[model samples]
Every structure is written in C-alpha cells, then in structure tokens.
Target chain A: MTLETNRQLEDLVAKAKSGNKAAYSEIVRMMMRPVIALTHRMVRDREAAIDLAQDTFVTAWEKLSSFRGDSKFETWLFTIATNKSINYLNSAARRTTERLDDVTVSRVSNSNPEDDMLQGELRSGVMEFMKGLPGQQRAVFNLRFYHQMTFEEISNALGKALGTVKTHYREAVKKLREHALAKGWTP
Target chain B: MNCRECQDELLLYGGVEALPEELSNHLDSCEACRRYLDEISEIAARFRADSDLVSESVDVERFVEGVEARIGRSRVDRLPAVTWVRHVAYAASILLVAGIMSVGLRYVDRDSPVNGVPPSTDQDYYAEEELDEGVVDIVISDFSSRGFLEAGDELLNDVTEDELKYLEENFDVRNLLL
Candidate 1:
C-alpha cells in the first residue's frame, strides 16, 4: 500500500471509531473486492459469498469501536469475514439433507474428451476442483493463496496461533498438490 | 530420515519456526528432499494461482446497501442508542407536554371555582378527563415512545434546580430516575 493510502486508511479508521457513517461506508467500499473474492473462494458459491461478505461487514461495523489498530483493518475485516463464512458453512452442513456420497468432486482436464470447451468451461473445471476441498482447508488456502495474506495475518484474524495457521496452510497446499498429482498434473 | 518424516517436516519448511537444528541440517544435506521441497513450493504456488479462477467480482452497491442496513440495526440493538435516545427525547417531549398541560390547567383554573384540586392527586387522571385510555396510554407508553420518552427526557435533562429540589424534598425522584 502507498503512504498516501495508508494515511487515508488511518483517517478512515479514526472517523469510523468516532461513528462517522460516511467514513465507515468508504472503508467498506474499499474492502468489498477482496472480501467478496475471498468469500467466493471459501464458500464456492457466488450468491452465498455475497451474503456472507455482507454479514462480515455488518459484524465489523457493529464491532468497529472495539477495533484497536493492532491489526490492519483489512486483516481484521478478513478475519471476521472468514469466521462468518466458516460459521455459515457449519450451519449449512447441519441443515443440509444432501448425501455426501452422492457429491462428486469436480475435475479439471485440458486434454479433450470433448473437442473444444471454452475458457469458461476451463474456469468452471478449476472451480469444481476447489469446491471439492474440505471447508477449513479451503478457507486457509483461499486466504493465503488468493488473498495473499501472510500466515501471521491469518493467525491474528482467525484468532489462531502461528503454528496452527501454518499447519492449516501447509495441509491445504499439500492436499491440493497431492490431489493435482494424482490427477496427473505436470507443473 | 525417511520420506514420511521428510514430508512432514517439509510441510513446515515454508513457515516452520523454532525448528530443531538437527532436522534443519538434514534438510540442507538431502538433495532429494530439497528437490521435493522445491516441487512442493511450485505446486503450492500453482494452486494459489488457481484459486483466483474460482472467484468472481461481486456487486458492490447492492452488497453495501444490505451491509449498511444490517450494521445500522446491529449498532442500534447493541448500543441501545436508538432506544436510549428515544427514551430521552420522549421524556423531554412528555415534560414539554406536561409543561404545556400545566400551563393550560393553570389558565383554566384561573376562571374555575376550586383553586386547590391538588393536581388531581393521581386519582385516575384519565377517567377524570373522560379520556378512553388514550391519554393514559400516551403518558404510560414504554420509555421508547416519542411522547413518553421525549417528555421524560426533558424532565430528566431540562428539569430546573427548583423542580428537582421540590421532587427531592417531597417525592422519590431518585427511584424514578432509575
């Protein structure tokens, strides 16, 4: 982040702490992209991701006064976002009557079983691979990889220890790698 | 060390902290394991890159509106700010109304026979006014109501020293304050 932007963020944080609605709104606007993107990857459902992201922001806003600038605002926001998504996933798992046995993990293959699939098909294929991951692993992978959050940031956000965060991240990577290799991915 | 141990420690290779020196030295010497670690790192990177493929941008406007509304409601609920403010405002209004009512009562009393009705002595003031529970309802509404809250708020906030002194001397205004 640029120095100017950082200063602006500090100003926003100050305003938000003082209950300035517009400052809070601007902060939310800036964070919307990463929040949505991370939620989408974690939940694997766009509509659900949006809902979870909204929930995350609402939770953040209500809890904004408690924020102490100990962590970056985005990191704090992501922590809340990831937790909300995880909780939603947990609740949905309980309410869902769908059979896990019937749920097939999707595969992404470039070699044509069919002649010419579009880029969208290829993207969907990758998504299917992601959707197959266990929930927490998916979350760790999404935040670390896609959101580019450091393990320390993840740990602080998730209220986890450094070892635990690293474990989740490593396990997530190892699983994805093993899964990819098993399906004959070269690089 | 065997491949299993190597892989386990390798998992920590990327972010392992406070490692035993012996294991760290072994990792340095083992070319095969080093190659494996490099491959793992590359695989992790690829997977990280692929995560972006699964995500799409979202509608900021719609999302912000929903988020703002929910946040506003939650703030109100959590802080009790809305309720408290309403209580304060209603109390103030009620006090204002009472002040107005007292003024009207005084004006009417100026032409009446009984100068000493003693402020109706809490004798179902509604029934005496022939009000069908409506006036009573207005005065007795929850602390959140505009009429009661504003009136009470004003009484609490704007009460004169003399009025408070009077209540202190003659009434349990302390208990009423709570």
Candidate 2:
C-alpha cells in the first residue's frame, strides 16, 4: 500500500547512500518508531525492543548494498526487521533467555502499585502464554496483531508463502483466544 | 465474492490501498458483508491502538547518531591498507634502529671483524689480539716441528735477559711446547 510518498523516500534513500548525515538521520528518525514498536511487540520487552531496533538498523546499514529497490523502502526496512527479530527470537529461545525479573520486582513501586501489579500480572501471563506458541506462529501473531502488518506484507517480509503466513496467524489467534479464555478473560 | 473470500481479503482492504470502485461500492451496499468488514476493521483498529501504545518517545537523534558512529568506527577499523603501511613502516624503523646500533657498536669499540663487521668492546679487541698472538705461536710451532726448529732456538738465545723474562712470562714457551 502506498502509505507515504515514494519519490520522497527514494530521494532520502539516495541521499543516505551518498553518506549525507542529515538524510541518514532523517531516515533513522522515520523508521525508528515503527521498528521499535515492532520489536517491542515481538520480544515483549521495552529494553530488549530498543536493543533489537538498534541492532536491526546496524544490520541494515551493513547490508544496504543488498537492498535493491524492488519494494517500498518501509517494506524493505520491515523485511530486514522481520528477519532480525525472528533470528533474535530464535537465538534467545535456543539460549533459554529468561524473562525480565525486574519488571516483577518493580511492580510494587509504582504510584498506583495495585494497578501496576495487575498490569504486570496480565503482561506476564500473556507473555508466558505466548511463549508456548510455535516460533512462526508467535512471529505471525506479533506482526499481525501488534505491528499491524497485513498477511501479504508479513508474507513478503518473512519470505514465506502467503498461505503459510495466514495459517500461522490463524493458529496463533486460536491459541491466544483459548489461553485468554482459560485465564478468565471475557470472550 | 462470498463472505469467506471477502473476510480473507478484508486485511488488505484495511491497509486502504487502491481498491476497485466496484468492490468498494459492494461493501457499501451489502449489509452482511459490511457488518463483517466493520468487525474486521474494528479488530484492525484495536491492533493499531495497541501498536500505538508506546510508553516513551524514542531518541531518534541519539539512536541515529549512535548507529552512524558505530558504522563509522567499523569503517575505521577496516583500514587494512593503512595498517599494512604502518606495519611496514614499523618494521623498517626497527631494522633502521638495529642497523644504527650495530654500526655505533663497531665504531665505539674496535676489534677483529665478525662477518666483516667489527666487534663492539675493548675487551673484545684485547681478546682478538690475544687470539692472533696464539695463532702466530701455533704457526711457529708447526714450522719448528717441520724444519724451522732452529728459528725458535736462535730467537730464544738471541733475546736479552729482561726481554727473555718478559717473553717467558707472557708467552710461557715451556708451557707452550708441552
């Protein structure tokens, strides 16, 4: 979808490629929020989200030569983000990375600590439930529900078949619905 | 299209791309499909809201600068050609220093040459001088053993008492013969 001006984006990309500081900075400014948002949803940790976003841009810069303007720059950017996010998730899973304990500890320190506690509990419950999902399903759910990516966009970004992406998303939604319902969320 | 097909394509519709006027008009006209479309749109809006629920504003300037700095540092790190030149210059410097040291050492303390390069101390000079004296003595001994035996006898007898005593103390002819 033509969300933004393609000619403007093309100009920005060209200027960035030429080592123009202002152009590069502008590109980062525009892409950072969406990237951070996507990573935050994918990993479900703000700090980790920031790290993942930074890593994503670093990787993109290094591999910028491979970006052949075949798709929208944002699409291409998100595609890089998707691969990086998935790889991060897989690597963290393989290494058995633990959830943030500080979030639990700090739950009692907020001004309205009860609200914080409830939110924290809900967040932890959802995260734990999400952890049980298969990798591709989890990714699809995060992209679809959290990043607001369409099935076709997600399919393109992940380099997966459209059917496969849709299937994973459907399965993810089904699993999440089951989990939420079991946890006493009103249907 | 059937409701199922329309449901499947609803997400693409939500993205608000250039849709055919006929499909748009159909969604507007059909109550059942419109209800389905509204539900899908509601779900999408909820997701959009969730995506927008960012707690903090990202430091875009800092982040961009940080990434740019990182890229710059990495580029600097890849100065292989410069590194090679520096390394060669370093090696040349060391070799030059060693060559200067060797030349200075020879000039400061003359002695018998080593590989055509002179020794580097007074002690070495004296040691080499002694070595030359020993060689001369050996050559004389070899001559005496063959047919130059009378030369040593005449030289020993021809010397004065003080001179002979000095020669004996320094060379020790009796010890040498043994």
Candidate 3:
C-alpha cells in the first residue's frame, strides 16, 4: 500500500479506538472481502467462512485497544483472520462434519443462476484440489496468489522463517501443478 | 542447467521471479522445461482466475449486515451472564467463609475454661483418681485428657459436690469412653 493509504487506515484505526462505530464499520467494509476469502479458502465452507470473518472483526473491535500500530492494520487483521481460519480447519468435528456442497457454493456466489452453477462447480473442484494441501501450505498459497502478499510479509504474518514460507509456497504450487496434471488440466 | 535444476526453478519462473541466467538460458533451450513451466503457469492462472471470480461474486453488503447484527447480539448477550455468574460465585465464597468463622468463634468462646480467660495449657489440667492402695492414677484418654477436663471442669466448677456425683452416676461412661 502507498503511504497515503497507510495514513488513512491509521487514522481510521485511531477513530475506531476512540469509540467511533462508523469508523469501525468502515474498517469492516474494507476488510470483509479479503477476510472472508481467506477463511473460505481455508475452511472450504461458505457459511463458516462468513461467520469466521464476522468473528474476526468482532474480536478485532473488542481487542482494538491492544493494537499498538507496530505493524500495518491490514497485517494485524490478516493475522487474526488467518489464525481463525486455521483454528476452524484444525477442529476435527468441523472437518469431519462440514463437507463442501453445491448448495453452499450457490448461496455464496452472487452471479447469475447459470454462471453461479458453473462457477460453483469450478470452485468446488479447486477447493477439492486445495484440500489435498496441508493447512499451512494452502494458507501460504492463498495469501500469496489470492491476496498478492509478498513472501516476507507472509513469513511475518505466520511467524515463520522466510525460507520456510518460500518452501511452503513452492510446495503448494507444485502440488497444485501435480493435481492439475493428474486431471489433465494442463494448458 | 540440468533437468533437475530446471524443474526446481520452474515454480520460481512460473511466478515470474528473477532467475539465474543459467536457468533462464536452459528454459530458452529446453521444450520439456518450457512445457512444465506452462503447466505450472496454467495452474497458477486457474487459481488466480477463480479467486478473482469469487471475489467479485461475494455479497459484501450482506456480509457487512451480518457482521453488524452479530456484533450487536454479542454486545447484548456477552456481559450479563458472565457478570452474574462471577458475582454469584463471589458472594457464595464470602458467605461460606463468614459462616465458618462465626461458628468457629462461638465454639472457641463457649468452650473456653474460665470467663475472659484463655483455655489452660495441657499440663495444667488433669483428671485424677486415688485408689484404695493410695496410688494416684491420671486418666490420659483423649476424652478424659487435659483439654477435655479443663472444658468440662469449667462447666461444672459452680456445681455442688453432691450434684456432680449424681450427674456422674447418671451419665453413661461407656459412650464417652468409646
């Protein structure tokens, strides 16, 4: 982000900390999509992702006082979202009981009926392949490709070594490639 | 670069990262490596395209409204139950401690030997009997021991000797002995 955008976010954070609900609401608006996307990719459940995203914001609002502004607000937000997603993924009950289905995909997609159906199939396929990845590797892949995060940034967010983050990203890509090849999806 | 080195660099190349000149040159000369790179690129592209599509298709307004509703409900639901339980537990603990202390203080004050005087030491009080052989025998059993005798004697100190003898004759010694 640019310096100006950073300043704007810090100003909003300051306002929200001072009990400005509007500012907090605006922060939620700004962060909701990425948070939901991150969670959806990790949990592979739309309703759970939406719930987790909302919970992330709620928790952030509750603990906003501890946010020292040491890192970017987006980084702090992403860390919370990531941890929540990983937690949901790690929960055995949720993993075993909550299978991805077409209904969930259709409900989450806002496209036209036909497009929604096709996109839902494609998304489920992608999610199925992604499920083969370990949670951390999948997280790395999603954060890098979907959110366009730098490896260094991901390392800081995950509290892992830079080399480790790179390895995860590489392994994620290699696994996806292998899956794609196995299914004859290569272009 | 060899095929292994080329394969290792495929992901980095597919991600468009700057690579060593040797790897770049190998990719330029190698069709197999190029095909592998294309496959990785295709997979990455597919992921990116799907991500973008999903991003555009999410309902932002619905999500924001849901979050607002949850936050409102949480604010209302969270505080009362926790505060009530905490206060109830605190009050119960205080009441329990007060009741114990009150009963303990009453027992100690009522059982003390002399009025406004602390109970006597163990060696200062004893129940003794003189046999026909003129031997003094001290009863050291717990119920007849020094502290029990002090408390019992303090309770009976004002009684007449005849009354004390009558009470002792009427009281069942077996229960106290057990």
Candidate 4:
C-alpha cells in the first residue's frame, strides 16, 4: 500500500527503533488510513479493522529492531498489515464481520432495488456491490483503487504473484459490473 | 467465439483497446456482449469514483493512542491469548511438580502396609538431600512460553515417575494447580 504523499518515513522508523514513542506515533498517524482501509476491506468490518490495524502498528513497534530497511518502509509496513489481516480472516476466532458503520452509506435501504438506483444511491450501491466480493478479491481491488498501487506493488503487499493479483482484480471488476447490471444500472 | 468464450476474452483486455480480429469480429456480430464489455468499463470507472466517496476517515489520535497503550506493556505481558495459555500452563506445571514433591516426600507412609502386605524392598524413596541441592532444568520445548519458574529455587528431583503418576491419579492436579 502506497501513501499518496512521498514523504520519507525512514528517518521516523530509525527514531522509532531507537525508542522514540513520538516518532512511532507520527508513523501511525501517517499510516492509519491506508492500513485501516486494507484491514477494513479484508475483514469487512470497522471495529475489527481498527483492532487489526492497531495490532499491526504495535507488532511493528515490537519488531522494529529486526527491520533491515531492505524494502521501502511502506512496503514492509503494509506486508505486516496485510499478513495480520489475512491471519485474522483465516483465524476461527475472527469476529463476524459487521457491515462497517463508518462506511457512511448504509446498504441502499430504499426497500425497492430499482427505486434505490437513483443518482443519490450510487455510492451506497457501489458499497453494496463491493461488499459482495470475496475477501481476497476485495483486498486486491481496494489496494489498487484507493492506494493507487500497481499490480506488482499490490502483489508484493499481498504476498501474491503479480499474475494472481491481476486475476483477482479482473475477476473483481467482472463481478462488480455484473452486480451493477443486475441492480438495473444501464450501460 | 461463443458469448461465454467471447466475454471471457473481452474481460481480459477489458473492452477492446487493441482489438484482436477474432474477438472484434465476434463483437461486431454480438451487440449484447459489446454492451456487456461497455458496462464493465463503466462500472469500473463509477466504482473507482463512488468508492472514493465512501468515507473511511479514521480518528488518527485515538488510533495512535490505542497502539501506544498496547506497546506500553512488556512483550511478555502483551503475548497473544494462545501464547499466554502456554505460559500459564508452563508456570502451573512447575508449581504442580513442586507441590507433588512436597506431598510425596512429607506425606507418603513408607512404613504403611499395602493391602495387608509389606511394601517392596526396591521401591523408590525421596533422596536424602533437600529440594535446593541441585537445579532442575524443566526443559520446556518453547523457551519463550516459560514465564515463571525461578530455576534452582524450586527443584524437587527426588520424586520418581511412579510417585508422579500415583500422585497425579490420587489428587485433582488440574484444580489444585489452577
């Protein structure tokens, strides 16, 4: 997951490794959304996303000494985040994913599917469409869409092959379009 | 290509930019598949835009504080639940061994008759030396999981395997340990 800003986080990482809580806090502030966004898409819930994202940050802090700076900080950081999210998803203990309350658009609550496809409902409709995607596909699509990560970057972040990542993205696109047409969205 | 095959092919290039002759001819013959590919592109564009609109805004300060609070604990204290269980089990095992040793050494009646007969001459007994004479290395496989057990402070090696099994069966060890 790439941050939009190109600000260097390595200096902060060094300070953090040397036991600067303030520096670590700054890193968390910078990375909170991208990490949360990935977790949210992976787990499909708000509270769990925050919990897993916090776990990622805390784990990073504990393991900060071992970070060799071999890869970009964001790449390393996202690898941890993505792995945690995937683990939580695979773990039987993961809480059932409630539709994220933070998502702002509740799932097209107009009672009539056709009537709900008005101009104002597209955002929520899209949210509904996205919610229906499989967890891995959702993770792949969101990393590409929100973070502007290339397929290779997402593949590295997700620990998937580049071809597999593209396949996930392509499948996700196909599913979303089919879902939209089924919901009466015209060409 | 048939519609399924044609759609699969179109889904790859995502709406015919470099138009392969075979797929282009198929698309020209098939208006519905063309419409399907067009809708796929449109959906992708709209999805990108609309997903951006859904607010994923996080409370940064609160989130940072949460991370800070978690990391503030010692690494051992912050171990996950399964690891914590292993730690507790290890610590409890040491305590159990010590308790069993004390029970075996002090409470066992070496002179008592067993079912109206005298005890075997070769039966194992407690050592003459006390519990503090030597260190008992309780070799827990995962060292990180061992939290308690201050080494030589609790060594009770005099208890034999028979004594441990007998004591384990006679006593409610799990309840006693916990």
Candidate 3 lDDT, A53-132, residue by residue in tens = 88999888878878998777887888888888888888888777857544545544545878776566667668787778
Instruction: Summarize candidate 3's per-residue lDDT along B1-178 as a digit string, tens digits.
Output: 6988788767754754555688779989999988887777777776666663333556887877777777676653356787898899999999999999999997776457554555455332222111111111233233355576564554355445654564455444334433
DockQ of all candidates, in order? 0.21, 0.13, 0.24, 0.22
By lDDT, rank the candidates, best first.
3, 4, 1, 2
For residue A11, model 1's alpha carbon misses the true position, in angstroms, by: 2.8
Candidate 1 local lDDT, A1-187, one digit each (tens): 5688778988998998888878988887887777877776666665677788888888887888889998778778888888887887788563373222111123233476562243334345456666677767767766776666777787766777888877877787677666767755535
The Cα error of candidate 1 at residue B11, in Å, is 2.8
Candidate 4 lDDT over residue span A1-187, tens digit each: 2354435577788898888888988999888777886676666666777888899888888888888876677767777887787788767665464354444555444576775565347766666776777767877776665555567777877779988987888787677667877877756
User: Candidate 1, residues B100-160: lDDT per residue as tens digits?
Assistant: 9999997676435343434445443332444334433443453345564456665556555
lDDT (tens digit, per residue) of candidate 4 on B41-155: 6766665555432224566687788888888884823447758789999999999999999888755665466456644453333332222222222322222343334321122
Locate the minimum summed-lDDT window of 10 residues in model 1 chain B: B48-57
Each predicted model: what fraction of the native A–B Cα contacts (within 8 Å) does it retain?
0.46, 0.25, 0.45, 0.48
Off by over 4 Å in 4: A1-4, A93-103, A107-120, A184-187, B1-42, B51-57, B74-178
Error of 2 at A39 (Å): 1.1
* Consecutive 10-residue window with the lowest summed lDDT within model 4 chain B: B128-137
Q: For candidate 1, what is the TM-score?
A: 0.58
Consecutive 10-residue window with the lowest summed lDDT within model 4 chain A: A100-109
**Candidate 2 error regions (>4 Å):** A1-6, A92-95, A98-133, A144-153, A173-187, B1-37, B52-55, B75-178
Selected candidate, larger DockQ, 1 vs 2: 1
Misplaced by over 4 Å in model 3 are A1-7, A104-121, B1-6, B9-13, B16-38, B52-59, B69-178
Q: How far is B103's C-alpha from truth in model 4 (Å)? A: 23
Q: Which of the two candidates, 2 or 3, achieves a greater lDDT against the reference?
A: 3
